[model samples]
Target: MFTTNPFDDDKLREECGIFGVSRAETASAIVALGLHALQHRGQEAAGITSWDGHDFHTHRAMGHVAGNFDRDEVIRGLPGDTACGHVRYSTTGETSLRNVQPLYAELNSGGFAIAHNGNISNAMKLRRELIRRGSIFQSTSDTEVIIHLVATSSYRTLLDKFIDALKQIEGAYSLIVMTPEGMIACRDPLGIRPLVMGKLGDATIFASETVAFDVVGADYVRTVEPGELVIVTNEGDIRSHRPFGETHARPCIFEHVYFSRPDSIIDNSSVYSVRKAIGAQLAIENPVDADYVIPVPDSGVPAAIGYAQQSGIPFELGIIRSHYIGRTFIQPGDKVRHLGVKLKHNANRALIEGKRIVLIDDSIVRGTTSLKIVQMMRESGAAEVHMRIASPPTKHSCFYGVDTPERTKLLAHKLDIGGMQDFIHADSLAFISIDGLYKALGETKRADIRPQYCDACFTGDYPTTLTDQDDVVVQNQLELLAERVV
Candidate 1:
């Protein structure tokens, strides 16, 4: 029986979401609403840890934000002007409350709390080292490693301690740290994930997506640049710093294809528009002789619209997603995982029956789900499932934040296009070219400032490495990622 993980679950795994509030009177309440916007990223566990002048208070539960923190008392319990919240889908540790984030630690230097997005590649090695040095762990999450590092650092300054700790660990991270004085937001150098900063009248907010700022009525400031840090004080003084190994600002390309909301902007580009352009490019590159175009649904809808417009084929909603189904149950078994898929999506026979359909999706990971999806389309009487991926093949795993399959499990790594076509039982299959992907991102001008695309999953140039004994890999593909930022 296959275990359901955020990275390998039958249904899509929500990305991790983070929210940090500085100088807000109702920080906890604002965090709750922001978490709601980012709920799309993670659904397994929710937590908020706030630091008042005196101490830090934490409220965490193992469910959606709505269920875990729906009550007034829960939010009310976490009182503070500076706060940080996390919604997690456990890419590193088991899905238990013990691993849920916004990890609060009372250090000898002072009291502080941290909420982190993305995964650390060197967690296992670091954890073992910490254990040898008398660091006891309260949780299995790689996030806790930061706490240990911070506690053990010899640096006198808090920021220096933070920087020292960050230097030791490697991988994708957009961290929101809360202290009695202020809040600090930091993003990794390679920029494999998205993190943005915003502000209201007298408050500052940091989130994984721009939509969270809109939800909390905060004015969008800008994205926290790769390898940059923003520190906000209770007096409303915001300081920004960048201490990183030199690397290109290659934010995850998949963000535009799937992870980001269509409305959210990453690296100052509209996600929805970029995805549409990808579809349009796909149509130009691989014009299939099909009657109609069908989106995989939800993520695929916008791009499919672009594909339909560019391909001159009628866009059809050939698949429907069921929003009511619960993701997990008391039982942790294949039956539950299978039931989860059934609850999540189904084919629309009326729309797809006997149709010469062109399928548009963001990308294909393992051959299992895509293969199953192809079978569902065939069962719905799709005459020819001509699959066109919006992005190129994900042939490598992400050492950053995403839960991609290992290099070996990736179908693209194992099979050629023809092999994949046969494996998925599709009549025709074509993926967007790397050039086409850059064009979709609107790289028309010769602007060196915009950063290069990290097609690691497509090109096998990972930002970080997994040479250490840790199950997780560091954020930046040391050699490649280091050069990009430098």
Candidate 2:
């Protein structure tokens, strides 16, 4: 299927979004509303699981949440007072109905359902061991590993078994789990992924972003602290545990750059404010003169405004984006298919004609989108199109729940700034420095101390070891060595 946003093809995709609420009326409806607020996080599939005290009911669909969960019949079918839902883009698992979550299973303790929003770096290593030990598998999703681990743990209680499962995994995650006993929401030790707690009347809510809470008219309480597991029981008792102990937190830096909605709040900072700060930082670091400071469109708006303010350049709508387009269209021919890009974004030729405009974008991944956008600007009679990226160059693949291209496929990995400028055919191009990015986040330069955020895509300073990826590398080398010997 084709993407609705043509310019989004080269962007890094956030793997998933999760939401859960307990002690709420029509819990599945609340989950659906929350998931709609988080649609940007993932769009490939959506699911909601609700426990109606006696049994768990779920509806999983392979598309946007609107078409699947917006129907009354669908929400009514999931009868319960507590529910959790997920939107998935398949960073690790295959894209199929089987891989959609909240994945449910009947354990010895009772019914259990889980919705996950992150990647498990050691999943493949653990999966092999679980299979070797006779655990029957289901989906290929790394999240299923958590279920198997919990099922096989020798602990007496379900809570202990869940904690035991957490200890065996690595990498980033923020999960919402539902069982007969309670609803559990927790983050990985480093808190590489974000999860926030909110309140709606008597109900307790948990979501990947505060925006979800806002959508359902819930008040944001605070972030679920790093390494903390918060449980809201069937009896309405709320408890917290710091099972992983204290550890330095390293949340994904790109959330501020791209993943989150501008209206969301993360770590007490407004996402919109942070993005604007990033643009201001970009302007301070790379001053440019142009007729108009134009944003690439919605995502780039805040940054463009910040840049325009900082540089004293007038911001203009050089490109207009259409929000009404569907996810895909049947491509009958090459010419028609190429026009799909214009259906999403078209040049405002009247404003852009004979103007030297600076296009501000969040980030450049493979540079394919940037190239198309720049070419569009030129075709609109723009005298010169300068490009300013809000974030630092992405040079490494993300293993923490983001769908990223391989290292070699990343344009930043393959090319220097000058090369990228030429490749995108921009009159000039500049990206925020790594130091500038930290400064925007209200921190000192990266060189001055250990990094506070997971900027591994730019700096390659991974917060956790990637066992599965390393195993693949080692296997590839072993095969190469055998080939040489033969």
Candidate 3:
């Protein structure tokens, strides 16, 4: 039981990344390229489904997109001018090939393929009701719940049925659906996840991030507006529909902090610029004197640069990360396995020795990696290690597609600022204030104005009703009562 990157275990992970292209000869290839750019979002499995007019072709595998989808044979088999794909990191379902996307099914309307990027908060409750109504399930994925909803919909037209299903569901979803009619892309009312539209020649493309379009030489058109659905007909007619009433958009704020690529443009602002702004705001709020500013590596780089520039402290690579680790490698014994952190990251002792340092990271979830990284800095002879987190302390769990640890397990939920500082063994630890985070996003405090993005993980102000979670609580109480009777 060797594994993927052990260092990533402490961070929040997005559940899926999706890409689709309509009316293009190179649809599958372009989608594969887009998924490659979004590989950071999900690494467990990859899938692609393409419709060749009369029939649908699909290829799915349990691994990264490069090895599975980059092959010519795989792309050749999926011959279609309309296609969509998904890369998954399972949160609501079992991790198996059966649960991979784009989850396709033959329906009365014709072949349907869907790639989903967010969770359905009421999926469990809906699943129970659907099951009782005799809708046999093929996979345990929440995404399949939508398929069943569409199948059972009594609305006359396929589009009408799809809209009816969307109205019944709650919580976040950015979906790219392919059908015999054409391709459809949409976002949830609150837009708790991200989805973007793009163009390459006359072809229409949809992806989880704008960076995806950049990869395949496509021009970004715009973000698919929250609660809005855009449909592209096989005959190439495109139309927009707003089934849900106008609602305040609440795109995930963490996208600017960690989930999205630095080069991505989110909400008309550069993600790199926003992270740097977050770092600058953090520096203003929690200034500390140190010899050099160090990033945790990769995702933390942009913010670190911002903190450094604002604080007038030189930025240096105090930690070096190795990117070539395999998904599963030979772990000889406990002693060797215990050195797991060293496999992916190492303390740059030469730069760290005898120096006081400031370490910048995107966020501290469980604080396990933070504690380990601080320990590494100490062992490398650093006099002091001050940890600065770019986002507000994540005290709540996210049910909207992110794989967040339970609230009880979150380090911020269990400990106050001082307690967490002590737990991680850093000289000091400070996360950006909630108000400061909004400032970085060019907004006032949430109390002064409507929230522009979903900061529920930090503030616990979830915008939607969590029916499945409530169901779980009721079920737990009933089970306890039954035990007492027994």
Question: Among these predicted structures, which one has the highest lDDT?
Answer: 2
- lDDT by residue (1-486, candidate 2, tens digit) is 534344356878877999999999999999999999999899889999998999899999888998898888998999999999999988988888999999988888888899999999999999999999999888989999999999999999999999999999999999999999989999999899999999999999999999999889999999998899999998788999999887888889999999999999999999999999999999999988799999988899999999999999999999999997755444436667656668778999999999999999999999988898999999999999999999999999999999998999999999999999999999999999998898999987875445788989999999999999999999999999999999
Off by over 4 Å in 2: 1-7, 447-449
| Local error of candidate 1 at residue 56 (angstroms) | 0.8
Best first by TM-score, ranked = 2, 3, 1
In model 1, where is the ten-residue run with the lowest total lDDT? Answer: 1-10
Model 3's lDDT to the true fold? 0.91
How many clashes would you count in candidate 2? 0
Instruction: Report the C-alpha lDDT of model 1 over 158-203, residue by residue, as the tens digit.
Output: 8899999988988788899988768899988877778998887788
**Candidate 3 on 1-486: residue-level lDDT in tens?**
324555567889866899999999968998899999999899889999999899999999988998899889999999989999999898889888999999999999899999999999999889999999999999999999999999999999999999999998988999999989999999999888999999999899999999998899999999899999999999888899988988789889898899998998997899999999999999999999999999999889999999999999999999999988755555447767657777778999999999999999999999888998999999999999999999989999998999999999999999999999999999999999999998988987666455777889999888889999888889999999999999
Off by over 4 Å in 3: 1-3, 330-332, 448-450, 482-486
Model 3: colliding residue pairs: none
Q: Cα lDDT of all candidates, in order?
A: 0.82, 0.92, 0.91
Candidate 2, poorest ten consecutive residues by summed lDDT: 1-10
Question: Per-residue error at 207 for model 2, in Å?
Answer: 0.5
Model 3 lowest lDDT segment of ten: 1-10
Q: What shift in Å separates residue 403 of candidate 1 from its native position after superposition?
A: 1.5
Better candidate number, 1 or 3, judged by lDDT: 3
Error of 2 at 108 (Å): 1.1
Better of 1 and 3 by TM-score: 3
